[model samples]
Target: MGYAQLVIGPAGSGKSTYCSSLYQHCETVGRTIHMVNLDPAAEHFSYPVSTDIRELISLDDVMEELGMGPNGGLIYCMEHLEDNLDDWLDEQLDGYLDDDYLVFDCPGQIELFTHVPVLRNFVEHLKRKNFNVCAVYFLDSQFVSDVTKYISGCMASLSAMIQLELPHINILSKMDLVSNKKDVEEYLNPEAQVLLSQLNRQMAPKFGKLNKSLAELAAHVFQMSMLSLLFPAKSMA
Candidate 1:
């Protein structure tokens, strides 16, 4: 069976950078990994894409011709990709061997992975093609320094899990850039109570009860999702 990694992250979270670095490292080791660009709006790329969604439809063309805003245009482009999966994506997959490893560098739009049907449909198409797919999520390490922002990241990751329900790997990217490594490293072995206490201190007393509930919920979800516990640091497999 074929294997795939859907590289996903917020804008400026280093998805493209990760893909480039991974491709280069693989090349150095004399290993071949196919990189597929799924971001129709992506104007530049660091890795050579084996198959680019832009070739089928581009955000620029959609925006200029349809007079849609950037966000709307991006959504349109992705939906168009979903619509053409059988024809274009299928043909592209046919070019690869059954055991080939593909890394899909996807768009940075959070909505696409959270609530949108586009990526859900896209993953379904891959499964139908006999590929075992795993979502590789990149979360900026800076967010971990602040509890509120860290919780926001968790919520976004949880939303993605709910939407796609794929085997996933959560990565705190750009660790090299984090000036306060200790604060970021703490999450590697997360203590829910400590996190909740920290979160409550950051917010007003009026939200204390609500914060507790959210904490319990986060703990429960993290355990059940098993995403956080599964990997401290991982390479795509």
Candidate 2:
């Protein structure tokens, strides 16, 4: 049996930085954990990679050979990886020891984790390999300062949680960068009533019903799916 954290988030949400920090912290304390790079477009990463999907299929080659744009090429690249799962990903993971902890730094493509079956299939593969997987989603702290953006992040996260259907964690990344920590404090401890009140003030009163449901959705996933998982990082392994 092995344990894994599937680190996922939007583009520029500090997913790689988080993985690098975790790797460095673990090394500093004399702990063993493998970092796997699942992003084919990843050009520069500081952490040592145990398994890399680019070794199998690269996004650049797909773009050039297939005559596809970046977005289409990325989807195609991931689909190629998905198709080779039984042969490629299986072989890569087979070498890891039982009970070894791994953190997979996945691509930022929202479709892969949201509606697409690709990431879901990837997690299924991990489970078949005896991995206890948790989807760790990172939302940029700066993006969620306002009510509308906050709801957007919440909804996106909830969609990913339901799609993945694994243990989920929502992290507000770049908290340290936000000079006024108090500014983004409400989102950290999401309260339905507070969100609703704020939403009512910002959005038109005619859309009150929509705001309420959105707040309820936000509160439900924030509490039931993610809140409990926001413990000290060192304890995850």
Model 1 residue runs over 4 Å out of place are 220-237
For every model in order, what is the number of clashing pairs? 0, 0
Worst 10 residues of 1 by lDDT: 228-237
lDDT of the structure predicted as candidate 1: 0.83
Query: Candidate 2, clashing residue pairs?
Result: none
Of the candidates shown, which would achieve the greatest TM-score relative to the real structure?
Answer: 2
The C-alpha TM-scores of every prediction are 0.91, 0.92
Give lDDT tens digits, candidate 2, residues 24-116.
889989889999998999999888999988899889998889899988988888889989999998898889899899999999999989999
* Residue 105 Cα positional deviation in candidate 2, in Å, after optimal superposition: 0.4
